[model samples]
Target chain A: AQSVAQPEDQVNVAEGNPLTVKCTYSVSGNPYLFWYVQYPNRGLQFLLKYITGDNLVKGSYGFEAEFNKSQTSFHLKKPSALVSDSALYFCAPPTNTGFQKLVFGTGTRLLVSP
Target chain B: GAGVSQTPSNKVTEKGKYVELRCDPISGHTALYWYRQSLGQGPEFLIYFQGTGAADDSGLPNDRFFAVRPEGSVSTLKIQRTERGDSAVYLCASGSGPSGANVLTFGAGSRLTVL
Candidate 1:
């Protein structure tokens, strides 16, 4: 079945340090990957997406994701972590079934300490 | 509106009762979708609507979960005989273009709790 996986349940980073939230997908064809963030009591907010373009894609709040086809990975990254960045991150990729439905990962919680 | 809007931010009810959640998509967005988010899990696709028709309902868990978009702008997700297991956050999102390339704007969501 086509799906996306977030290997880490939680990631911890100190303020001013770089951070990475890993995501890998298993799909039949080319995938359109997306990243969303959810703060406490808030809905998921779109961060970035990779359709067909350069491997690197940047998004809001200084967030970026690198789409690596060979590795079947699209990991979210930030150059410097902020305490405000602590939230739950999800990686979503289109499902094999025709339509716009997305298959989302379990999610990764990032904790940034000041 | 500037963003997708959902009503009844929180709802608590007894098991076996019925519930309805409403969603108002962003102006001019032709595609709307509904998803459910369980505790500690990612959002799961429930249904998708293209204009006034349901293009896909494969993600809906069962017949009891029904969604309708009559005018193609607002939608209502209705649950029949709600159960404790159905307690979750119902999310609504809207997109302007085709599925693969479209970026969805989501609402705050309606939280439902069944006792």
Candidate 2:
């Protein structure tokens, strides 16, 4: 089964500073990685995806992620974090072998200090 | 175009009571899915509907839980004899294609509370 792991339960970052949320995955075939964010009482919003392209993919709100095949990791990063960026982040892998499903991470709470 | 929408943002029902949650997928979406999310946990798949047929129902916990997308547009998830453990947010999502590569757009979930 395909799965995603986010080692950190929570990450606190100072506003205007760089921030990164790590994500790693285990899958059988070519991986389709995704990052989503959830604010209070809202649905999960798509941030970015790594289908097949340059290892670096940019997404909403100046957020970007690096897809490292060797490391099997897709880490979300931002050059300068904002207080409004604080929310729950989830990393998911889209599995296509036999079963077409997305395995989501446990979620990491991000706190940005002003 | 409008995004996926779910009805009854908050529902509180007594234990063992029947409950129904509705979802309206995006216009012309070919796939719809139902998932449940407990507090502090990620969403778990419950069922998936392709057009008017249920392509996958294996994720359903028991016979008490059933879902139908009669028109391939709107879907209803019904739960009979709901238990306290069933209390969670029920989320609905729709994507344009059946492939895992398709981006799924989700709705504001229906928060179900079994009292």
Candidate 3:
């Protein structure tokens, strides 16, 4: 079974500072990794994914993630955090046998202080 | 629908009662998925549909949980004898491909509360 682990339960960062949400994965035969964000009372929104490409993958809202096969990590990063960037972040691995199901991490709540 | 839509944004049911949650995936999306999100945990896979058939149901916790995706668009998840443990937000998602690499659009989710 493929799984993702987010060690941090909550991450606190000051506004305008760089932020990184750590994610590590375990799977068999090259796995797909993804990052999703959730605001209060909202669904998980797709942020970025690593399928097959460069280690640096970028997604919505000036966010980017680095996929490190050696480290078994795909940590989500942003150059500068915003107040609005505060939310719950998740790291997931492919859960679909063939139909795109996702197995997600416990999630890390990001708190950006203004 | 513009995005994956789940009905009854909030559902309140008594323990041991039965409840049904609905999901309407985006039109033209061939893959539909159901996930359960506990209070502090990330969403966990429940089942997935490739077209009108359940391609994978291995994530379903027990026999009390059942899902159907008739007509290949809308899906319904039926839970029998719901327990307090079953209380969580039920999420629905859809993707353009059957492969796990495809991006999925998720719904706001139906918050299931078992009293």
Collision pairs in model 3:
none
lDDT of 3: 0.91
| Tens-digit lDDT track of model 1 for B1-115 | 9999999999999999999999999999999999999999889999999999998888899999999999999999999999999999999999995567788899999999999
Q: Estimate each model's TM-score.
A: 0.97, 0.97, 0.95
lDDT tens digits by residue: candidate 3, B51-84 = 9999889889999999998899999999999999
Error of 3 at A2 (Å): 2.5
Which numbered prediction scores highest in lDDT against the true structure?
1
Regions of candidate 1 where Cα sits further than 4 Å from its true position:
none
Instruction: For candidate 2, write residues A1-114 as lDDT tens digits.
Output: 678899999999999999999999887778888998988889888899998989999999999999998999999999999999999999998656433456565699999999
Superior candidate under TM-score, 2 versus 3: 2
Off by over 4 Å in 2: A97-100
TM-score for chain B of each model, two decimals: 0.98, 0.98, 0.98
Candidate 2 clashes between residue pairs 3 or more apart in a chain or in different chains: none
Better of 2 and 3 by lDDT: 3
How far in Å is the alpha carbon of A31 misplaced in model 2? 0.5
